[model samples]
Structures are given as structure tokens and as C-alpha cells.
Target chain A: MSEVKDTQGQLWEVFIQTKKGLPFKHFGSVHAYDKEMAIQNARDLYTRRGEGRGMWVVPADAIVAIDSSDDESFFDPSNDKVYRHPTFYELPDGLKNM
Target chain B: MDNLNLSKFCIRLGDHCLIMAHRQSELCSNGPFLEEDIAQINLGLDLLGQAEALLIYAAKLEGGTRTADDLAFRRPERQFHNFMLTEQPNTDFAFVIVRQYIMSLYLLKTYQALSKVEDDTLSGIALKALKELTYHERHFAMWLKRLGDGTEESHERTQTAINELWMFVGELYEEDEIDFMAQKASYAPTGIEMKTFLMEHITAKFSEATLETPHSIYMTTGSKKGIHTEYLGYLLTEMQYLQRAYPDAKW
Candidate 1:
């Protein structure tokens, strides 16, 4: 299908931090006219269920992503680096979260 | 403090919330876009939850057999004590935002006072609802600014809405017998105090939005006696249809 024209302002991606010490995870996107509106729309859409303690909204166009054509070159090289898994290391007994 | 008067007071507040919730619900699927649609519905749900809490407390205080559902769905137009402004029709998006901005500010101040009252139940409910109303006030205030200052057409529509709704605001601060009694019992702030605070805040916000407050001298009044605009009855017909058709029907 052809790309549909959008008149609903700008697109914003929402990230939500479920707890104070945790990092914000990508939740979803919403359409808004400005930064304040983007934040409010993210709040109304994603945080209605007490889902987050903090939120961040970024313009959708600001994100940079690799194209699908580059997936093989970008990801295949990492698979052969088995020593990077840190399996040869030994940990002390009291280390809990390592 | 008279239990009868206190119960009536709770019913008045609950009716305001219930009717406002119904009005917001009317815009559920009709918002300008999907995000706005969800936002409006979320607002309605917040009001609905508040209405349930207040009405349940009112029923308990009255020692009545009627449940919150009965209070919401079974009351006739004349029995509802909501302010006339709450029942006003959503003539347009500008009207809806303007109405919400006014009512949210009114409720924010009222609830702030109630949160400090001597009554535990009412004060507790007010404390919790206060948090929600804070966001409601901010959201609408933002919209009011955008619409008021956006474009020529939007500015005109927003100004017209303010001019039309200005008259109904007087009813919010008119001290009736119930309000007088509540004030005597320290259950609420005095009408003059609330009016002063509301008008000052409204003036400041309107100035920020580049909107002028109408100085119309003919302020309408009468919601204290269960009187409302003609729009309320039709709204009730639609809201109460299922319950009226099948008495005691449950989802």
C-alpha cells in the first residue's frame, strides 16, 4: 500500500522506566504537535496502567537505524567471536549479580 | 455537622463528577485523533472513578439502600445537583477544552480545601482525587493556550467559547443553604474565597493563552437547586437508556 498522508502532527517514540533505578525501555509511539504534547500523549497512552515511574519522548525522525540490507554485515561478525562470551572467567563466591 | 446536609453535599459533588464524566465519555470515539481519543476517555474514567467514590460515601452517610449505580442511573434531571456548567453541551473542541479548564481549576481549588477538612472520609477522597485533578487542570490549560493562540480561526473559536461559558461560572461560587452549612461545619472553603482564587488563576491562565475573559454582568445561577441547562435531560436519556429499559440490569 502507498504511504498514507499524516496530518496528526509529528510522530514521537515513547520510553518508560518502570522503576527508579531501572533504564527506560522503548514502549511505543504517539502523534503530537510539540514536545509538551508528545510527553502528555505518551503519558495518556502508555502510563495509564501505572506502568512507569519515568518517561521520555523523542521525535521519531531523530532515531538512526541500520537498513535491512546491512543486517548480515553488521550482525554476522559478532557470532564468530565466541571468546567474548566470558565463559573462561571464574567468579568469586559472593558475587551475586555478576 | 448534620448528616443529612453532609450527605447532600457529597451527592452534589458526586453529581458534578458523574455528569462531567458523561460529557467526556460522549467524546470518546469522536476525538480529533486516536491519541486524543484515548486521552479524553482516560479523563472520563478518572471522573467516573471519582464519582463512584463520592456517591458511595454519600449513600453510606444517608443510610440509604440505593447504591452508587442507582444514584448515577436512576436520578431524574431535577434531582441531579451538578452545576449547570458541567452539563453544558460540547459544542466544539474549543468548548470542551474551555469547559474542562474552568471546571478543573474549580475542582482543584475546592479539593485542595477539602483535603484539609475534619471529615476523614471526605478528606481522604479529596486527597486522592486532588492528584488526578492536578493533571487534568494542567492538560486542559495547555490545550487552552494552544487553541487560544494557534491561528485566527482557532483563536476566535476559543474566545467565543469563553464568552459563552462565562455566565455559567457564577453558579459555581454562589453560596446556597448547603454550601453555607458546609462552610459552618468547616467542611469546605467559603464561596467568596473559592471565587477569588478561581478568578485570579483563571485570569492569569487566560492572559497566558492570549484570551480575554468576558466581563459580562449577567451571570446565570441555579444549579444549587437542581436546575440546569436544557442540554442535561437529553444527555441523561442517552446515559440512562439501558438502565431505564431494563431495571437492575448488570453487565
Candidate 2:
């Protein structure tokens, strides 16, 4: 069982968008007891300029990020895969929404 | 009951915001961490922005030559009508949060009440400010719960902060001539209505935080009538120093 009680003061990863139709970007983290409070606290702390239409607060522990120490091995193969690029495809004349 | 009264009312409103903003601004560099420091300053800026808006309206109401800077800087400490809660020193993160938590709860209701004022200016101010206070209330409500229930040390510290600040809170809802004048002018909520609403609201949050409410004791009242704790003088000195030192000097 994931115990919230034992994980007090744990970090939360906050993502926010400055407005609707804007991409969510990393803003900041706050130490909170739960997801709801974390998001509210993030809104209070971050979106003062009407800078966000929405926010996402995920507990840092819940994020399974790839280890940065293994960055070269884990990400290098994908980086060199130019064949994965959409540039390989010729665009039609009216291919407006790339 | 004329524009003069309206001006005074708005100045009082601005004073509340400016004093609280200055106090919160003091937290920017000194928060427990970078994130909280940013959050505290965000609130501080919100309050200062609100003060500017209200003070401008107050100046117009007075039909005075003075600007917001004049009122904010030229007045002596005795003339400021802000609550002592806003003027108190930021003792610690817990202390600041507790004070804000309680004040947010009260201010949420205060603005809601103000929204019904007959004065268009007051109504507009209240409506817009209500939106800001909604988030403020939510943010601190969460902190109050987290700190209260997080750990033994956090709980005890938050509880102590709440108890110490409880005395200052009563002044927020304490009605006097100003409130009565507001009511008479159809520009304020009745004290009875505001009190009942705020108490029930605060009680629910306290219950959720799993903390016992401080017994209603030593709840001082009088800030609205210009009486304040000793701390107000020092805060005014800091806030008004620049303006006082160089009167009429423009940026």
C-alpha cells in the first residue's frame, strides 16, 4: 500500500498552461499531503497572471522517470533514429495541420 | 453617507490589502523554500494590485487631488485602519500560513458580502476580489490540513500558530460604526449574517484538518476603528519610508 502518511513533504511535479490552447509546461513543485491540495497550492503559487487555464499535479514519487545516469544508453538510440522522423514523408499541398 | 464616506470606505479597504500585501511581500526571500517563497510573493502581489485598484477608486470618490501614493505614504500610522492580523510580523512559515488560512476564510465571506453592495464601485471591487480570494482560501485550506495532519511536529506547530493567531481573527468580523454605516448605505453585510456564515465555514475546514478549534478566548476586536497592535508602527515605517523621504518624487 502506498502510504501518504509516511510520505509527508514529498515533492509534486506541477505542469500548467498559461491559457487555454497553450501547452502545459513545467511550472514548479510544492510539498503537499495529497494530489488535490498540491494542485490548488500550485494554482495559488503559480498562476497569478492568469497564466494557466489548467494544471496537473502528480506526485514526484509517482513519476517513473528514466534514470538520468543512463541517459546516453536509454535515449541515444532514439535520437539517432532519423528514420522515425516525419520529414521522410512528402507533404500534400494542403497538409495544413502538421 | 456621501462620496466622502465612500472614499473613506474604499481607503479602509485598500489599507487592508496594502498592509497584508506588505506583510506577505516580506515572505518572498524568506520562505521555507523556493516554491513557498514564490507562492507567498504571488499572494503579496495580488494584494498590492488590489490595493492600487481600490485606492484609485477611493481617490476618485473623494474627488481629491491626492493619488494612491499620497494616501498610502502620507498618512501616519494612526490613520491606517488595517486589521492587526495583516500587520503582525511573519514569525514562521507555520505562523504565516495559519494567519493567512484564517484570514482567507474570513475574507472570502467578506468579499461575498461586499458583492451585494448598492455602490457600483464597491460591487465591482468585491466581485473581482472574490475570484482571487476563492483560490487563496483553497490554497491555504489545503496547507492548514496538510500541516495539521502531516506529522506530530507539523501538527503541533500549526496548532500553536492557530491558537496564537486566533485572538487577532475576532477583529475581522467585529462590526462597528463603519459596518453600520455600510449597512445604512446599503453597502455592507450585516455583522450577524457575516459572522454566522464565516463561523460555519471555518468550522468545516477545521474539522477536515482534524484539528480542534481553539476555544473562543481572548478574541480581540478594534482594528476597524483604528486601534492596532504595536507592530503596525514598524510596518508603516518600512512601507512608507521611500515615499516619506522624497515626497512628490516621481518615477
Candidate 3:
């Protein structure tokens, strides 16, 4: 079948924070015409099960992603950089979060 | 504190939620999009939850062998006390949104008043349902503005819906004997208060939406006395079909 035009308005990505002090993780996406509609749609779609205490909606097109073809060049070099690893430095016994 | 009237009052509240929930549920798979479909169903679920709570309380007030399920499934058309607006058909998305906007406005005010009533159970139920109705009112109001100002076709259709459903808006605050009894016992807001609030909010919201409020002087009434539009009978038939077919059916 030929591709049909989508008239359901713009796409939005949803983020949900399950608690007040927690970070908002990427939840899902919904189609809405504007920011207000996007937020409401996200609330209805992603938070219906009480899974979220806070929500954020961003335009799907607003996100910038790296090209998959550059994955090896961009990411593989970091894998062998042993000195950059946090475990490479031994922490003193009294050290805290470090 | 007449138990009979108070019980009847609870039934009226429960019936409104039940009928409206059923109307929302009818559009389960028929929403314009997947997100919208789920949203509408979620609205239905919220209303159904409120209905069950109100009906259960109504049954308790009656002090009978009746369960909430029995009150919901066994009641006949003439016995239901839902507002006529709640039973209107979802002709289109515009109609559904308009109907929901009107009902939500009414319910929000009603629940706000009920939350402070003398009765503890009713007040508790109203407080919880008030939170849900707040979102419901805002959601529908947003849709109303969107449809009213979005496009020419949408604007025209939404205007048509507002005009069509405007006739039933008056019945929401129509003062009847039951209403008087509830108001007397501190169980509900006065009819005048409800009417004034509804008129002011509706006028302001309509202006914001760039929609015209109908100038018609004729308003339909009579849901309080169980007199409803013909559409309700058909709706109840479908809703009660399973229970009527198998009297002992269980979930």
C-alpha cells in the first residue's frame, strides 16, 4: 500500500519522573498538535497507571542523534582508553562518593 | 437527614457518572487516533471508578440487599437520574468534546460543593472524584478551544456541536424536589449557585474558544424525575445486555 498522509498532528517524545526527586526517564511518544496537547497526551498515555509524578514533552524532531555509520569511530576509541576509566584510579579507603 | 432523600441523592450522582462513563466507553476503539483512543478510554475508566464508589455508597445508604452492581445493572430506564446531557450520543469528535466540557464543568462545581457537605462518605467520595474531574474539565476545555479555532472545518463543526448541545445545559442546574432536599440537608449546592457558576464559566470559555453561545431561549428539562431523551433507552439496553441475558453472570 502507498504511504498515507498522517493527519494526527506532530509527534512528541515523552519523559516521566516517577517521584519528585527522581530524574525524568524517556517514556514514550504521542501525537499532538501543540505543546499543551503534547503534555496532556503524555499524561494520558504514559502516566495513566500512576507511573509518573511529573512529565515533560519535547518535539520528536528537536532531538539530535549521531549517525549509526560513525558508531565505531565515535564510540570504539573510548572503549580502549583505560586511563579514562573511573576504576583505573584506586580510591583511598576513606573516600566517599568517588 | 432523611435517609430516603439522601439515598436518592446518591443514586442521582452515581447515575450521572455511570451514564457518562458508558458514553465515553462507547468510543473505545473509535477515537480519531491511538493516543486519543486511549485517552478517551482512560476518561471512561475514571468515570467508572467514581460511579462504582458513588453507587456503593448509595446502596449502603439504602440499607438494602442491593449491591452497587445490582443498582447499576438492574435499574430500568425510568429509574435512572442522570442528566440528559450525559446521555447524548457521541455524534462526532466535536460533539463528544463539547458534551464532556459541559458535563465536566457541572461535575467539577458539584463535586467541589459536595466535598464540604455534612456527610462524611459523600464528602470523601467527592474529594477524590474532584481531583479526577479537575483534569477531565481541563482536558475537554483544551479540546474545545483547539477544535473551535484550529481550522475552518473544525471550527464550524465545533460551533455546530455547541449549538446542538446548548439546549440540554439548563437541565443540569434545574432545581427539583430532590435537589431542594439535598440542599436543605447540606448535601449539595443551591441550584442558583450552580446555575450562576455554569453560565459565567461557559460564557467565558466560549468566548476564549472563539465560539458563539447559542441565543436560543428554549431549554429542555426533566432528567431529575427520570424523564430522559429516547437515546438513553438504547444505551441502557446495550449496557445491561449481558446481565439481563444471564442473570447470574460473574466476572
Candidate with the greatest TM-score versus the true structure: 1
Tens digits of per-residue lDDT for model 2, B30-88: 87655667777887887888899889998888887888888899888778888888887
Query: lDDT of all the models against the reference?
Result: 0.91, 0.79, 0.90
Model 1 whole-model lDDT (C-alpha atoms): 0.91
User: Mind giving the per-residue lDDT tens digits that candidate 3 earns over B135-191?
Assistant: 998899999898988899999999999888999998887887888877887777887
Task: Please give the distance, in angstroms, between residue B223's alpha carbon in candidate 2 and its true position after superposition.
Answer: 2.3
**Model 3 clash pairs?**
none
Chain A TM-scores in order: 0.83, 0.71, 0.80
- Model 1 C-alpha lDDT per residue in residues B1-251, reported as the tens digit of each score: 67878889999999989999999999988999999889988998998988999999998888878888899999999999899989989999999999989999888887887899888889999999999999999899999999988999999999999999999999888898888998887777898988898899899999999999888878888788878889999999999999999998978
What is the DockQ score, from 0 to 1, of model 1? 0.93
C-alpha RMSD over true interface residues, model 1: 0.4
User: Candidate 3: what's its TM-score on chain B?
Assistant: 0.97
| Better model by DockQ: candidate 2 vs candidate 3 | 3
Badly placed stretches (over 4 Å) of model 2 are A1-11, A17-33, A44-46, A60-97
lDDT over C-alpha atoms for residue A91 of model 2: 87
Clashes of 3: 0
Q: What TM-score does each of the candidates earn?
A: 0.96, 0.83, 0.94
- Single out the weakest 10-residue window by summed lDDT for candidate 1 chain A: A75-84
